[model samples]
Target: MLKEFTIQTPSEGFVTITKQVAQIVEQCHGEKRLCHVFVPHTTAGVTINENADPDVVKDMLLALNHMVPDLAYQHGEGNSPAHVKASLVGSSVSVPIVNGTLYLGTWQGIYFCEFDGPRQRKFCVNIL
Candidate 1:
């Protein structure tokens, strides 16, 4: 089975979407399946990481900014760096589900990366 949804990000940063994914899993009502989440965008990505600490996300963004400084890119759109960063991070995350729960590490979380400004983004969820 497959389900898709859209989320609006406020700005260029990470937005935790664990609850939303969890809700979808609950709605699935299946015994066991692989949950695949995919984002289709050049300037956006998805990842599994620590959401318990805000600083973790902050430091990550900071580090990424340091690595790929905003002013370093010469793309006309001014968002070429975002596309690069998204590519580096990736555009999807797949998690295993068992007993109706996601099998993730203790501090792991689902994050939606928004490199561009506030916009509507879509994600696909496939239970297989």
Candidate 2:
């Protein structure tokens, strides 16, 4: 099964979409399956990381900026850093669905990593 949802992001940051994914998993009729969450955007991506502390997200963004500063890119759009960050973060995440629940770690959650946003984005969830 497949489902899609939209999210509005800030200039750059992480948005937790774990709950939305869990809701979709729950609707799969309590089957044990694998869920693939995909973000089909060049400047955005998805990942699994710590959700209990905001500092982790902040540190990750800081590190990415340091590694791929916006002003240091050859791309004319000036958003090459976003593309690099998205590539590093990846565009999809797979989680195990068991008994209608997502089998994520206690402190781990799914995140939409928006490197250059302030725009509307969509992610698709595929259950198999």
Candidate 3:
């Protein structure tokens, strides 16, 4: 099964979508399955990380920006850092679905990493 949703990111940061994805999984009838969440944007990505603390997300973004600071790049769009960060963060995440629920850790949550945003984004959830 497949589901898609849109999100509007206010700025560059991690937006938790764990609940949304879990809701989709809950609607599925399967007991055991693999849930694949994908971001189909070149300048954005997906990940699973500590959702209990907002600082974790802040630190991650800070580290990424420090590592890939915005500077002159060949990409004329001026979002080369976003592309690099997206590649490092990855475009998708897979979670195990058991008993029709996402098998995530206590502090883990799914995040949509927006590097170049304050814009509309779309992500897809595929259960198999």
Candidate 4:
């Protein structure tokens, strides 16, 4: 099953969507399965990372910004850095679903990485 969700993201930061993903996973019935979370935006992506410490998110964004410097690109849009970051981070994450729950580590959580402006974004969840 595939479901879409909307989220308002910051100009450039990570938004923890663990709870929302979990809620979606809970709806599936029977046996162990797999869950895929996908972000449908060029400047956005999804990842599974440490969410217990807020600084982790900040550090990740800082590192990404540092790595993807604001340099001229062939693309007319000035959001080349965002596109690079999104490519580096990837657009989807897969997690194991056991007993209708996400089987993530204690500190691991699902995050939506937004590298562009504060805009409305859409992500999808697929249960298989």
Clashes of 1: 0
Q: Where does candidate 1 stray beyond 4 Å?
A: 71-74
Q: Residues 47-116, candidate 4, lDDT per residue (tens digit)? A: 9999899999999999998998878698887889999999999999999998778999999999999999
Mind giving the per-residue lDDT tens digits that candidate 3 earns over 1-128? 89999999967999999989998998897899999999999999999999998999999999999999767799988889999999999999999998878999999999999999899999999998
Cα lDDT tens digits for candidate 2, 1-128:
89999999999999999999998998887668899999999999999999999999999999998988657567898889899999999999999987789999999999999999899999999998
TM-scores across all candidates?
Answer: 0.91, 0.95, 0.97, 0.97
For model 3 the TM-score comes to 0.97
Please tell me which predicted candidate would have the highest lDDT against the true structure.
Answer: 3
Whole-model lDDT per candidate:
0.86, 0.93, 0.94, 0.92
- Residue 88 in candidate 1, Cα distance off native in Å: 0.9
lDDT of 2 at 64: 90
Ranking by lDDT: 3, 2, 4, 1
- Which residue pairs show collisions in model 1? none
Residue 125's lDDT in candidate 2: 97
